[model samples]
Each structure stands twice: as structure tokens, then as C-alpha cells.
Target chain A: MLKIEEYRQIIDEQIQMLGGMKRPEGLYDPVRYILSLGGKRLRPVLCLASASLFGEYSAALMPALGIEVFHNFTLLHDDIMDQSDVRRNHPTVHKKWDNNTAILSGDAMLIKAYELISKSPVGVLPQVLEVFNKTAIEVCEGQQFDMEFEKTSDVTEEGYLDMIRLKTAVLIGGSMKIGGILGGGSLRDCALLYKFGLDIGMAFQLQDDWLDVFGDQETFGKKIGSDILNNKKTFLLISALNRLEKASKKELLHWINRKEYEAHEKINAVTRLFQEAGVSEVLIQKRDDYFTRSLENLGKINGDHEMKQEIENFVHKLMARSR
Target chain B: MLKIEEYRQIIDEQIQMLGGMKRPEGLYDPVRYILSLGGKRLRPVLCLASASLFGEYSAALMPALGIEVFHNFTLLHDDIMDQSDVRRNHPTVHKKWDNNTAILSGDAMLIKAYELISKSPVGVLPQVLEVFNKTAIEVCEGQQFDMEFEKTSDVTEEGYLDMIRLKTAVLIGGSMKIGGILGGGSLRDCALLYKFGLDIGMAFQLQDDWLDVFGDQETFGKKIGSDILNNKKTFLLISALNRLEKASKKELLHWINRKEYEAHEKINAVTRLFQEAGVSEVLIQKRDDYFTRSLENLGKINGDHEMKQEIENFVHKLMARSR
Candidate 1:
């Protein structure tokens, strides 16, 4: 059975092999630029890995590329919407070029994604497109909810979970399902895979919230407590808001409402309040619960035993990352 | 035997029937808002007409909606890029909602277009997607070139024509081709339909340039000579720049280079130069040539006689429109 690293390597190679987007330097250059900025390639890797579990993984390559391209297209436009200047330690497309370039290039990348995904075998093309289109629209809705939550002071944990489910988890789930379908997995097996992926995605996002506060900055690849600094509604913040006592809640709200404050001081204050509210422990428990549920789904899938073990090992490694 | 007006009415009915995009009002509302701001429905009407020429027009309805939705998607984003406030006598999406709303909603609209197009029967789905994807990418390239041309001088007529073909004509051509494919037209017939649509598209855009200067304000539905005021590069402007005498060329150049000039004076001066160089006659002749070529392609189609005549009459009605 192929390991997770092997799948990721395949994805990287396939992504690099993408070419023939030559003309209109103004349009294609940003696409190439964004794709070149390396990330974990989690979605495509999961797709290829899931495909390998049932049959040949190679058929999943084009669809996997489609998922990754769609992901990056969202990022390019999101950066402009968020007014974010830096991404992966480099200037964003909008900042490096201009807003119009980002918008137009992002649009082209989206069309490119559709073209790639349409390469799926004709027999399963309709089903593949169905999953992709639903995921795509959900991703946009997730973004809308995320933006709305920024202004709405009374965001619920349920609402946050639903938002992340739409924004982040559905695409992850859909990617695995698409791979499974292309891999000749049975409908029952595909459904199991989708559930597995959804649970894992939820855990993955919860872990992201955890890492923003508890993990080391070098390991997290982002500044600790940056979410708090932005007053970004995360799992931890929502949980904290629910669990905090009146006095502590007042203090937390004061910090959140503050227009200006020293960075370290605010981070320190929020971190302390979160611990006092005991939401850190609650978040850890919830993340582990989701991880366990994901394993349950994965274990139930009637695929090759070695392949199942490989997937299990991969998720264990993902969950075990600490720092 | 259905006339163009009947095709248009069918398009209007189908467009009105679009529903089930309920949640995330922040996102879907703008989509509904923009679609409500109607236009000629020319693309969809053309698709339906071409489909009727070969076989069942009903089979083409979904794909026709796909074309129109895709067209509107481009317009939504274009309004943002152009910073235009008004469209179809109402505030544009960006102006009415916001840029982020327009951007995200426009993205969803693009996905909706794909979903609608994907409803094409399994036999023709792949071909339909092929045409749509190629056209979508070309449209973006066209927009990029259009933006580039704004900052560029000495843009040749040939280059300008290529840009418009990408930006405008290909979608028109693709729409017809998709309709033909869905309508069970032969490959040769579909190819001819594409050519017909392409030629008509070119003529339609050139007529737009003509009407901007020569069109009556009330009848044209836009300010006369607004393109001149904006220093837009049209066939007349480019032709006059090429054909004018030395003294007249300098005068034209003076107006073109001037950062500040009376709008009416500039419009009058440029209008005079265009007439003097006889480029108005040249443009009219070129537009007529395209119309003639379009008729040649339509005449070659081995489809229903009345359908062909209907298409011919439709283009005639289009070309004959003047202020």
C-alpha cells in the first residue's frame, strides 16, 4: 500500500506537470504563481490515497488537481476580500499584481478547475460534477457565513461548526468521495469514505483552532493568538464565550471590543481567559471525539486491510502533530 | 417555425423559473438581483434558435440558461472591474450590494452555470462541457486583453479584433455550438452554426461601436459618444488614426492625448476626423461583410428551412436596428 507521503509526492509532481497555460501572461502567471506556493496538499493527497484504497489512484489525478485549483482560486479571491497582503511568506496575487489581476486570474483558475474535473471518465462524469458543484457552492456559502460572523457579535458554536462544515469540511469530504467513485469503490464504500472524510475534516479544523493558541508558532506556521487579535470567531472563542463566568466574560468582551492594544498583552489576556473558562480542555475533547468518529468510519469501510491501516496511520500522524 | 420573439419568451420563462438558491441571502440575493436586471437575452435566444434549427429546442433550454448565466456572471465581475455604477438603468451589483458580495455571488453564479450546463444529456454532456469551458476561458482572456488595451496605444485593428473574438464572439459561437450539439445536429452542422454565430457576434460588437457615436441617445439606451469621452479604442478611432492626413492625425492625437478637454468638443472633433477619414463608411462596410458571411454560414446549414430563415430574419432585425 502506498503511504500518505507517496500520495502527496504524486500530487506535487502532477501539479508541477500542469502546463500549456502559456498565453495571456497577465492571466496565467498568477495561476502558476499561486499553485507554486507549496502547502500540505491535504485534499488532493486524501483523494489519491482514498482512490488507491479501492483501485488505481492514477485516475484520480485530474480530479484531485481540480480540487486543489479550486481551493487556491478561493484563496486568491479571499485574500483580496480580506485585504490580506501576505500568504505563505510572499505577497498575495492582488498585492503583487493588482486587485483586478487577482479577480480576473482567479476567475480563469476557476474555469481551469472545471476543465480539469471534466476529464473524469464519461461514465461517472455526471456524479462527479454533482459532488463538485455542490461543494463549490457550499464553499462560497461558508465564506459568506464567515464574513457575516465577523460582524455578528452573537455567533453560536453550532453556527460556527455549520459554517466550517460548509466552508472546509464538505470540500474535503467531496474530494474523497470523488476519488472513491473514480477508484471503482461501491456506493456504500464511497458513503463510508465521505463520512470518514467529513469527520476528519471537522477534527482537522478544530485542531486548527487549537493550534492557533496552544501550538508553537514555528510548528503552526502562523503567529499564536493571531485569531484572537483579529477577534476571529473560532471553535475555542465560541466555546470560551459560552463557558466563561460573568466577570471573565466581561473582561474577554472588553479585550475583543478594544480598538487598540499591545499585541502580546491582548494575546496573553485572551489566552488566560480561555484557560479560565476551561474551553481549551473542552476543545481538546471535541477534537478527539471527531478524530475517534473519523476512525470509526474508516474502520468500517470494507477495503483492503493494508490500505485501511495506511489511512489510519496517516490520520494518527496528522492528529499527533504537536508543537 | 418559432420566431426569435418566441425563443426569447421561452428564455425569459426559464430564467424566471430558476429557484432553490435560498440560503445565505447575503450571497444569493445579489445573484437574484443581477439576474432580475434584464438585458436582450440575445445569447440564450440565439442558443434556442440554433437548437430549433437541428432538433428539439427544449433539450437546449438548460444549456441556454447556462450561457446566459455565464454571460451575466462576466458582467457582474466586469462592473466591479470597470467601476461602473449603473447597468440596465439600475445600480450595478457592486454598487447595490458591495464588491465582496458581487465577487462571491458572481462565483456562485458561475458554478450555477456549470450545474445548469451539466444537465445536458449523457450522450452530449462531454461535448457541451468542452465548448462551454473553452468559451469561458476565452472570455477571461478577452477581458484581460481588454484591460491591457486600455493602457496600451498603437493597438492594431487585427489585435483588437482578436480580443473581441475572445471576449465576445467565442461565447456567442460556443452558445450556438452547444445548442446544436444538444439538439442532435451533425458535427458539420454544428461547426457551421458556430461560424454563423461568430460572424454575427463580430458584427454585433462593431455595430455597438458605431452606435456609441452615431446612435441616438434615447434609442441606443446609452449616452451618445460616451466611448469617445472615455477615450475608448473602437474601429473608427483606430481606422481614423491610420487613415487621417498628417495635420488631421496630429489634431486627433491632440484630443486623444489630452487629459482634460470638453467632452462635447472632443466628441465633435473625433467625430469629424472619423467622417473625414471615411472610416465610418469603412466600419459600415466591415460590419456588413461580417453580416454577409454570417448569412453564408446560415444558408449552408442542412436543417429546417423555416428555422434557418428565422435565424436569418433575427440577424436581419438585429443588424437593421439604427437610431
Candidate 2:
């Protein structure tokens, strides 16, 4: 079995070899540019780690790369939809190029992701595609729901959780399941891996919500509270809304309503209100619940304990991030 | 073998059965809206027609519907990119909904297309996906080149043709090829069908360019010279640039350059200049050459002559649009 670091190295090398970067510079330049930005590479690594637990990690490299590309494709489109100016502390695709270029290139990336996974073991191609397509459509649905939440004030905590599950967790779960499938894991084991990934993915996103308000600026690589400033309906905000008294809720809404207040002032006031209403504690508890559930699910997976422990270590490293 | 009407009916019915219209009204609403505002359903019909030539057309119905969904998906995205306000006398998706909705819904449609085609008969699923993926990527490349052409002044006639081939012809070819694959046709026949569709599709697009400046407004459902007013780099414009004398080119450019000329006056002068340069006859001959070649390719396909004749008739009906 490969170590976690070895799986990561394999994924990175495989990505470099998957060539489509050529002419039509307008189409591919952004693809190559974003792929080169070199984020955590967490998703593909998880895929390889899962594969290594049951079979040769090398056998699953292509599918692992496919998951990574798919992950990036979602980010590329999401950046445009959010009108985000920065990603990885650099200009976003829509910022570096134009929106038209970003949209077209992002579309190409989505199709390329399908092409990447298209070479799955022939016997398993249909199931792989089933997972891939279902996840893809759900991701789109999740994005749609996120956008809808922005326009509505009636969003519940359950609704917010479901949205994130669709938006983030499914891809993670699907990736691990895909890896397990490539590893020739039994259906039961693959299903368990998916549940583990899903719960862990939920924790990962909630941690992100937590980090947005509390993470160190230097480590996070972006200013904290941008989510607050943007009125993002993150778990912190949603939970705060659920728990805050009418007066406290009114104060939170007032701070949220200010369009032109001092950035730090709004963030401080909102964070203070969140702390007073126990929003932070609620988020921490729920996040821990997910984390525990994820571990429990991971424990149930039928694989070598050593390999599973390696998987557990990788998750801890990711979840423990401040950046 | 089926009649043309039967093939079209089958496609339309299959489309209605492929349901996803539900909540997140912002998302599926536009999908239903655009699908409702249907056009010729040409690509999917071609898929069915090709399938009927060798095997059970009914078996290929789902995939045939997939081609239509895929075609509409392209149109939805293209409408946004082109900033087109109208399609088939209806507001474009971006106009009807917002740009974000159009973008997200268009993405859903693309995924939906893959889902539709994913149900290809088990024996042919991989090949179906191969054709679909290649065509999908090439279409994006075509759009990129088309967008690139807008900024390029040195677009050659050859370059323009290649762009249209990628942007437009390949999908037609791919759809027929997919249909041939579904029908269990011999590889040689499938290839011939692709060539047939390529030539015929090329002819179809050229006729569209011709009709844009010259067709009947009532029948065409759009104003003539719209492409001219928008400065579209169509085959006519590219060919005129290729063939016109320097002085004549200057005059045409002068007319083209005028921002606020009387619409009819500019249209008449351009038409007269095109006639003087023999541009009209040049286009007519080239279009016919493609048409003849398409028929020749169609003849080589290993299908009954009657089925081939039906496809030919459909081509003639499309090509016989106003001069």
C-alpha cells in the first residue's frame, strides 16, 4: 500500500501527463492555468488512498485525476457565478480572462472530466458514469439551491445543511466511491466509503464556515469575514439566525443589512453577536458530530486497518487545516 | 424503415418523456421553457432516421432524444454568449431568466444530455460516449474559434470553413455516427454516414448564411441582413474578403463600416456589390458542391435507397430556403 504522500505524488504526476494543453490558447490556457495553481489536491489523493487500500494505487491513477479535474471544473464555474476575484490568492479565471472565456473553458473542463473517467475499467464504466453523472447533476442542483437561498429569507438550518451536502459532500463521497470501485472493493465497502466521505465532507465545509469567521488571515490566504461581508448564508450565519433571540436576530440583521459599513466593524459586530448567541458553539458541536460520524463510517469499511489508518491520518491533516 | 414524419414524431414524444421539470423553479423552469420553444428538432431526428436504417429505431429513441437535448443545450449556452435576445421568436433563456439562471440551467441541460445518451444499448455505450465527448469538446473549440474570429481580421476562407465544420458540422456528423453505432451498422457505414452528415451539415450552415441576407423574413422568422448588421464573420463575408479586388474590397468595407446608414440602402448596396463580385454565384456553387458531395456520401452508406432518399428529401427541404 502506498503512503498518503505517495498517493498525492502519483496523482500530481498523472495530472501532468493527461495532455490537452495545446492550441486554441483561449480554450486551454485557462484550463492549464487553473490546474497549475496547485491547490491542496485533496480529492484526488483521497481517491488514490482508497484505491491503494484494496488494489494497486497505480491502477486508479487516471480515475483519480478525473476526480481532481471535475473538482476544479466546479470551482471554475463557481468562481464565475460568485464573481469571485481571487482563488488560491491569485486572480480567478473570470478575472484573468473574461467571463465568456471562463464560461467556455469551464464547459470544456466539465466535458474533459467526463472524458478522463471514460477510460474506467470496461466492466465498471457504467457504474462509474452513473456515479459521475449523478454527482454532476446534483452539484448543479446544489449550486442552484445556493443561489436560490440568496434570494430567500426563509432558509432553515436543515435546508442549508442539505445544500452543502449536495454542493460539496456528494462529489467527495462520489470520488471515494469511484476510487473504491476502481480498487475492486465490494459494493458494500464502496457504499461505506461514500458515507465516510460524505460525513467528512460535511465536516470539511462546516470547518470552512468556521474558519471564515475565525481563521488566521495569513494562514487562510484571504481576509477573514469576506463571507460575512458578502452575506453568504454559511452555517455560522444560518445557525446564528436559528439560535439568536428576536433582539439579537434584529441586531445581526442590522449589521448584515449595512451595505457600506466599515468592513472590520461589520465583521466584528457580527462575530460578537454570533458568540453571544452561542452560534460558534453550535457550529463546533455539529461539525464534531459529523467528524465523529465520518470516523465511525470509516471504521466500518472492510479494508486493512493500516491502510484505513493512513486514510484517517489524511482526513485529519485536511480537517485540521487553518489555511 | 420509417418515414420522415414518423421519425420526427418519435423524437418529440421521447423528449416529453425525459422528465426533470421540478422545483428550484429558477433552474428547471427555463429548461422546460426553452425545450417548449422547440425548433426543427433536426439533430435528434437525424439520429432516429439513421438508426431506423439498420435496426430498431424504437431502441434508439432515448439516445435520439439525447441528441436533441444536447443540441438545445448548445443553443442555450450560445444564446448567452452571443447576447442573442431571441430564439425561435421567443426570448432567449438569458432574457427570459437571468444570465446566471441561463448559465446554470444550460449546464444542467448539458449534464442531462449526457444522462440521456448514457442509456445507450450496453454493447454500444462506450462508442456512444466517445462520439458524444469528442463532439462536445470540438463544439467548444468551434465556439472558441468563432469567438476568436470576431477579434481576428485575417480570417481565411479555409479557416472560416474549418470553424463552421467544428462548430456546426461535427455535431451533425456525430449524431448520425451515434445513431449508426446504435443501429449496429458496420463501422464503414457509420463512417460514411458521418461524412454524409458533415457535407450536408456544411451545406445547411452555408444556406443559413445565404438566407440571413437573402431569405424571406416571414418564412425565416427573422429580419434579413441581421448577420450583416451584427458584423457576423459568416461564410459570405469571409468569401467576399477572399475574392474581392482591393478597390472593391475597400468599397464593401466602406459600406460595412458605416454605423448608421439607411438599413435598406446599405442592404441593397451590399447585395449589388456582392452580385458585381459574383459572390452570390460563388456561394451557390460551393453550397451545391457540398450538397452533391453529401448525396454521394449518403449513397455509399449501406442502407436501403428508400431510407437514403428520405434523408435526401429532408436535406433538400432545408436547403431550398430563400436565396
Candidate 3:
């Protein structure tokens, strides 16, 4: 049984091998530049790992890369939508190039994703396309809801969860399911893996929300509490909104509305407010619950126990990451 | 025995049926609005016509609709990139809504196109997808080259044709091929129809450029010489550049390079220059050549004579249209 790291290594190598293209200097250059940035390659790793549990790893490579490309395509568009200047410790495509370049390149990346995923064996392609299309649309829906929530004053936790499920979890679920079908896993196995991935993805996102507040700068590879500065409606912020009383809520809103507060001061004040409200602890409990459900879902898959254990360990290590 | 009008009617009905969706009003509403502002419906009509030549019209309806959706998706994005405020005699999506709405809605529309195309019969889907994906990527390449050409002065006729082939002709070719495949046409027949469509598409695009210059405003349903106002590198302009004396070339460049010239005056100047250099006649000859080749390709397809003639009539009728 190959370890999760081995699967990741394989994905990394394949991604590198997929690199080094020439021509259409405008179109292909940005694609190569973004893919070269190397953001954990986690989705492709999940794809390859899930496939390896039942069949040869090589069979999953194209679709695995397809998932990664699709993921990055969204990021390219999202950066422009969000006006995000930075991603993965680098200037975003839109920032380095222009908005038109970002938009066109993103469109090309999407078409490229379809071309790559179409390489799936004919038997599995219809299902793969179904999953990919559903997830792709859901991700867009998620982003829409995310943007909507940014303006609304009354965003509930349920709405947030549903948004993240669509935006984040479904792709993860679909990636694993794609691998399962390609690897000839049983329908039941595919379903369970999807559930496992969805739950794990939910936990991973919540961890992202929590980490933005409490994570170490060196470990997180970003400035902590930047979400607070942007007024991003993360789980932590929403939970804190629900937890705080009128005065505290007003104070938090003031920091949010402030146009020119000292960054560190504002971050510290928000962090203390979150601590006092006990939202951080509540988020920890929620994240752990999803994480536990994911593990249980994984345990239910009727595969080799050793391989299952390796996947289980991989999930744990993912949550343990600070960045 | 269905004529092109019958195919057009079916496409119109299908497009109308695709309307009436709710939710994500910001996202889906724009999709519906844009689709409602019908263009030629030529692509879908072609799809159904080709399919009807062998298979039932119903069999091709879904993929035909898919091609239309894909066509509109490109228009949605292109409008944004070109910063064009108008399309089809109505406000473009970006103008009606905004850039972000246009971008996201366009993304969703692209996903919707895939979903619709995925409904291609399982037996024919792999080929349908192959054609669709290749066409999609090529369109992006064409758009990229089109943008690049705007910045460079030395764009040749060959380079422009290749760009438009990728941008315009390939999708037209792919649409016919898709219909042929779904209609149970043989590989060779499908290939020939694709060639036919490509040649016709090339002619269609050249006609578009020609009309943009000399077209009657009411008949064309658009402002004549708008392409000249935008300094578009149409065949007329390119041919004139190749034919003009050095002094004539400098004078033509004077109008093109002028940042603040009267729109009518500039268009008149360019139009007169185009006449003097014989580019207009040259373009007519070029367009006619492509149209003839397209007819020749259609003549070679192994379909019934009457059916071929009806399709041939459709081709002529399309080119004969003022708008």
C-alpha cells in the first residue's frame, strides 16, 4: 500500500511533467506560471490516492490533474472577483497581468480542464462529467452566495455552512468519487468516499477560518487576522457575531467599519473579542465534529485496513497543518 | 425533408423552452435575459439541419441547444473583453448588469453548456465532447490572437484567417460534426460536413466584416462602419495596407492613430481608401471563394441530393441575409 505522501509525490511529479509548454505566449504562459506556484497539490493528491486504493495510480493521473487545473481556474476568476491581489504567497494572475488576461486565461484553463478530464476511460467519463459539472456550478453558486453574504448583515451559520459545502466540499467529494469510479471501486465505495471527502473538506475549511485568527505567521505563511481586516464573513466572525452581546457586537462592527485603524491593534482587539465570546472554542468543536465524521466515513469503506489507515493519517496530517 | 426554417423553428422553440428558470437571480436572470436576446440561432439550426439529414431532429436538439449556449457564453465574455457596450441591438450583459455579474454568469453559462452537451447520446458523447473541447479551446486562442493583433501593426491575411478559423470556423465545424455524429452519419460524412461548415463559417465571418463597412444600417440592424470607428483590422483594412503607396499608407495610419477624430470622417476616409486600394473588390472575391469551397464540400458529402440542396439553399439564404 502506498502512503499518502507517496501519492502526493506522484501527483507533484506528474504536475511538474505537465509543465513546460510553449506558444500562445499570452495564454499558455499564465497557465504555466500559476501551475508552477505549487499550492500543496492536495486535490490531485486526493484523486490519485483514492484511485490507488482500488486500481493503478497511472489511470487517475489525467483526471487528477484535471481536478487541479479546475481548482486553479476558479482561483484565477475568484481573485478578480474578490480583487484579491495575492494568492499562495505570490501575486495573483490578475495582479501580475491585467484583468482581461486573468479573465481570458481563466476561460482557457476551464476549457483545458474539460479536455484533460475527457481523457477518462469512456466507461467513466459520463459520470465524471456529471460530477465535474455539478461541482463546477455549485462552486459558482457558492461564490455568489459568498458575495451576497458580504453585504447582508444577517448571515446565519446554516447559510455559511451550505455556502462552504457548495463552494468547497462538493469539489473535494467529486474529486474522490471520480478517482473511485476510474479505479473500478464499487458504487457504495464511491459514495462513502464522497461523504468522507465532503466532511473532511468541511473541517478543513473551518480550520482555515480558525487559523486566520489564531494561526502563527511563520506557520500559516500569511498575516494572521487578515480576514478581520477584509471583513470576510468567516465561520469565526459569524460565530462571534452570534455569540457577542450588543456592546461587544457594536465594538466589533466598529473595528470592521473603520477605514484606517492600525492593523495589529485591530487584529488583537478582534482576537480578544472572539476569545471572550468563546466563538473560537465553538469553532474548534464544530471542526472536530466534521473531522470525526470524515474518519468514521473513511472507516466504513470496505478496503484494505492498511490503505484506509494511510488515508486516515493523511486526513489528520492535513488538519494538523498550520498553513 | 425538413428545411432550414423547420430547423430554425425547432431551435427557437428549444431556446424558448430553455427559458423560465428561478434562483440565484443575479446569476441565472442574466443568462435568461441574454439567451432571450436571440442572435441568428444559426449554430443550433445547423446542428439540427445536419442531424435531420440522417437522424431525427429530436435526437440532435439537446446538443444543438448546447452549441447555442456555448456560442452565447463566448459572446458574454467577449463583450466584457472588448468593452463593447452593445450587442444584438441590446445592451450587452456587462452593460446591463456589470462586469462581475457578466463574468460569473458567463462562467455558469459555460458550465450549463457542458451539462447540455453531456446529454449527447452516450454512444456519440466522446466524439461530441472531443469536438466541443477542441473548438472551445481554439476559440479562446483565436480571441487571444485577436487581442494581440490589436496591439501589433503587421498582422497578415494568413494570420487573421487562422485566428478567425480558430475563433469562428472551428465551432461552426464542430457543431455540424456533432449533429452528424448524433444523426448517425459515418465518420467520413461527419468530417466532410465539418469542412463544409468551416468554409461557410469563414465566409460568414468575412461577410460580417464586409457588412460592417458597406452594410445598410436598417438592413444590417447595426451601425455601418462601426468596425472602422473601432479601428477593427478587417480584411478591407489589411488588404488596403498591403496595396497602398507609402504616402497612402501614412495617411491611412493617420486616421487609425488619431485619438480624437470625428467618427464619420474617419470612417469615410478609411472607406474611400479601401475603395481606392481595391480591397473591397478583393474581399468580395475572397468571400466568394470561401462560399464556393463550402458549397463544393457540401456537394461531396454522401447524403441524398435533395437534402444536400436544401442545406445548400440554407447556406445561400444565410449569406444573403442583410443582418
Candidate 4:
């Protein structure tokens, strides 16, 4: 079985090829640009890793590229919707070009992704497409719910969790499941692998929320408490809201509603409230529980034991990421 | 064979089912809203008609819905990009809700379209998807070209024709080709059907350009010279620029470069230039040649004689629409 780095390298190479389409510069340039602004290539790597667990990882390469392209497509549009100026320390597509280019290029990238995924072996193409289409719809729904939550104050922890599951976790899970399908895993094993990926994704996202306020600034690669400054409805925020007493809850709400406070003041104040309410401990416990569950799910997969252990090691390394 | 109205009704009923997914009201509502504000349902109806010409029309139903949803998906995003205020005389999705909703909803609709198309019979699924994906990419490229032309002054007649072919004609051709594939038509016949649709689509768009200047406003159901008012580079405009004398070309360029002018005066002047250059007659002749070519391609199809004749009659009825 390939190491995680090997899988990532494969994904990176394929993404570079995707960027090489030169025609219709107005449409493809942004696609090339956004693909060049590299992320960890986590989803596709997981797909490759999962595929290698059961059978030939090579067969999963096209579908893996598909997932990467689809992920980037979402980021391209989401950056526009979020009005973000920078991604990966560079100007976003919408910022570099314009919204129309971003919208059209993103749409084209989606079709490109489908084109790539359609290369899945014919026997499994239908199943691969079904999972992908369902995941795609859920991701959009999740984004809608996330936007809706921005204006909504009474968001429940369950609602937040569900939102993240739909927005982030399902794609991860779907990626692994697709890899499993393409790699010739039995349906039963694929289902188990999917659960494993979903658990890891949940933990990964919760860790992200945790790191936003609590991690080392140098390591996190983003300003700590940026989510707090934006009054984002993360798991920590919802838990803090639900667990806090009257005064603390009112104070949190005040900071959330304030339009003129200094950024650090708001961030510090919200961080204090979260700490005082012990939300950090609650969040860590919840994240750890998911991590454990993911390992348990992985334990049930009927794959080569050594490869399974490698995946377990990989999961630990991923969850151990500080940012 | 189902009448065009029956085919339209089938598409309408399926689109209704699509909107029935009531969860994520923010995402689904705009989808429902836009789909409800009806247009010709042209692509899906064409798919049904073409499918019935070869085999069981019902076999094409899901894919037909797919094409309709996809067509609407493009419109939803195009309206956002174009900043169109109204569609079918109702507020566009972006105008009614917001840009974010439109982007997200349009995305969900694209996914929904894929899900529907994935229902194509397993035997032909890959071929159907290949055609759909290629067509989808071309449509995006076409929209990109159209937008680019807004800033580009050197756009040639060939470029404009190619843009419309990508933007409009391919979808029409793709719809018919997909229909033929699903209905068990010979691959050769499907290819012929695709060309037939493409030729008709080219003629249809040219007709639309002609009518923008010449049709009665009441009959056109839009401002008679809206394209002229917008400085859109239609076939007539391009033809006039190419066919005119040096003096006349200078005059046309002057009008095109003018920053401010009365809409009717500009439209009238441009219309006069087109008339003097005999561009209108050229355009009509070109459109007719395409119509003739479309009939010739249809004649080459080895489908049932009566079915072919029905399609020929339908083509005549469609082209005869003055507005």
C-alpha cells in the first residue's frame, strides 16, 4: 500500500494536469488559478488511501481527481459568497478576476469534475455518481444552513453539528466510499469505511473549531478567534451559549451584537466566556469521542491488517494537526 | 407519439416533483420559484420528441428532466451574471432573494439535474454522461465568450457564431442527442440528430437576433430593440460591420462608441445601417440555409418515416414563430 504522502503526490500531479487546460482564458484561467492555490488535498488523498486499503489505488485516481476538483469548485464559489479576499495567502478567483468569472469557471470545474468521475469503471459508475450527486446536494444544503445560521441566533448544537456533517463530513465520507467502490471493496466494507471517514471528518471539523480559538497562532496559520470575531456559530459557540449562566450568556450576546468593538476585545471577551463556561472541555471531549468512534469504525473494515493500521496511524497524524 | 404539449406537460410534472423536496427552504425555494416562472421547456421537449422518433419516449423521461433542470440551472446563473431583473416577467432568483441564494440554489439544481440524468439505463449511461458533460462545458465556455465579447471589440462574425453555438445550440443538440441515445437510436442516427438540432438551434438564435430589431414589440414580448440598446454583438451587427463600405463602417463604429444616445435613435440608426448593408437579408438567408440544412440532416435519419415527418413539421412550426 502507498504511504499517505505517495497518495497526496498523485493527487497534486493530477491537479496540475487539470490546471493545464489553456483555452477560453476567461473561463479556465480561474480554474487553473484556484487549483494552483493548493490546500492539503485531504479529501482525494483519503480517497486514494481508502482505495489502497482494499485494492489497486491507481483505479481511484480519476475519481480522486474528481473529488479534488469538486472541492475546489465549492471553495471558489464559497469564497465569492463569503466575500473572502484571500485564500491560501493569495487573492481568490473572484477577487483576482470577478464574480462572473468565478461563477462560470466554478460551473465549468464542476462539469469537469463530473467528466473525471465518469471515468470510474462502468460497473461502479452509477453507484459512484449516486453518492456524488447526493453529497453535492447536501453540501449546497449545508452552505444554505450555514448562511441561515448567520442571521439566526437560537441555533442549536444539534443543528450546528448537522450543518457541519452535511457541509464537510459527507464529502469526506463520500470520497472514501467512492474510493472503496472503485477499489473493488465489497459494499459492506465500503459502508464501514464510509462511517470511519465520516467520524474522522466530524472530529477534524470540531478540531478546526477548537483550534480557531485555542491553538498556537504560528501553527494554526490563521488568526485565532477569527470565527469568534465574526460571531460564527461554531460548536464551541453553541455549546457556550447553551451552557452559560444568565450574565455570561448576556455578555456573549452583547459582544455578538456589538458593531464597534475592537477585534481583539471581542475575540478575547468571547474566548473568556467560552472558557468560563467550560465549553473548551466539552468540545475536546466531543471531538475525542468522534475520533475514537472513527477508529472503531476503521477496526471493523475487512481489509489488510497492515494497511488498516497504516490508515489508523494516518488518522492519528491528521487529528493531531495543531491547526 | 406525444404532442409537443404533452411532452411539455411531462417535463412540467417532473419539474414539479423536483421542487417538492421541501427541506432547506432557502435552497429549494428559489429553485421552485425559478422553475415555476416558466419558459418554453424547449430542451426537454425536444429531447422527448427526438426520443419518441426512435423508440419509447418514456425511456427518456428522466434524462429529459435532467436537461430541463440543467437549462434552468444555466438561466439561473446567467441571470445572476447578466443582472437580469426579470424572467418570465417575474423577479429573477438573485433579484428576488439574493446573489448567495441564487448561486447556492443554482448549484443544487445542477446536482439535481445530474441525479436525474444518472437514471439513464445502465447500458448507455456513460455515453449519455459523456455527451451531457461535454455539452455542459461548452455552454459555460459559450457564456464566458459572451461576457468576454462585452469588453472585446475585435470579435469577428465567426467568433460570435461560435459563441452562440456553444451558449445555445449545443444544449439543443445535446438534448436531442441524449434523447436519441436513451430511446435506443443507432449511434449514427443520434449523431445525425445532434447535427440537426445544432443547425436548427443556430437558425433559431439568428432569428431571435433578427426579431430583436424587426419584430413588433407586442409580438416579441420584449422591447423591440433591447439588444441594440444593450450594444449586444448580434449577427446583424457583425454582418453590417463586415459588409459595409469604409465610410459606412466608420459611421457604425462611431455609433457603437457613443457613450450616450437616445435608445430609439441608436436602434433606428443601427437598423438603417443593417438595411443599407443588406445585412438583414444576409442574416435571413443564412438562417434559412441552416433551416434547410437541419431538414436535410433530419431526412438522413433512418427513423420511422411518419415520425421524421412530424419532426419536420414541428421544425417548420418552430421556425415560423415571428417573435
What tens-digit string does per-residue lDDT give for candidate 3 at B87-138? 8889999999889889999999888898899998888888999999988988
**Residue B189, candidate 2: alpha-carbon lDDT:** 92
- lDDT value for model 4: 0.90
- Candidate 3: clashing residue pairs, number: 0
| Two-chain DockQ for each candidate model | 0.87, 0.76, 0.81, 0.89
Mind giving the per-residue lDDT tens digits that candidate 3 earns over A261-310?
89999999999999989988898999999999999889888766777788
Per prediction, the TM-score for chain B is 0.96, 0.96, 0.96, 0.96
TM-scores for all candidates: the values are: 0.98, 0.97, 0.97, 0.98
What TM-score number comes out for model 4?
0.98
Ranking according to lDDT, highest score first: 4, 1, 3, 2
User: Tens digit of lDDT per residue, candidate 4, span A1-323?
Assistant: 44888888878888888777766987888898899888999899889888888899988999999999999999999999999999999999999999999999999988999999999999999999998999899999989999998887888888999999999999999999999998899999999988988889999999999999999988788989889987889999999999999999999999988989888888888999999999999989989998999999899888878778888888888777774
Instruction: Output the worst ten-in-a-row residue range by lDDT, candidate 2 chain B.
Output: B12-21
Q: What is the C-alpha RMSD of each candidate to the true structure, in Å?
A: 1.5, 1.7, 1.6, 1.5
Clashing pairs in 2: none
lDDT of 1 by residue, A201-272 (tens): 999999989999999887677888889998889998988888888999999999999998999999999999
In each prediction, how many residue pairs overlap at the backbone (N, C-alpha, C within less than 3 A)? 1, 0, 0, 0
RMSD of 2: 1.7
lDDT of 3: 0.87
Where does candidate 1 clash, by residue pair?
A: A216-A323
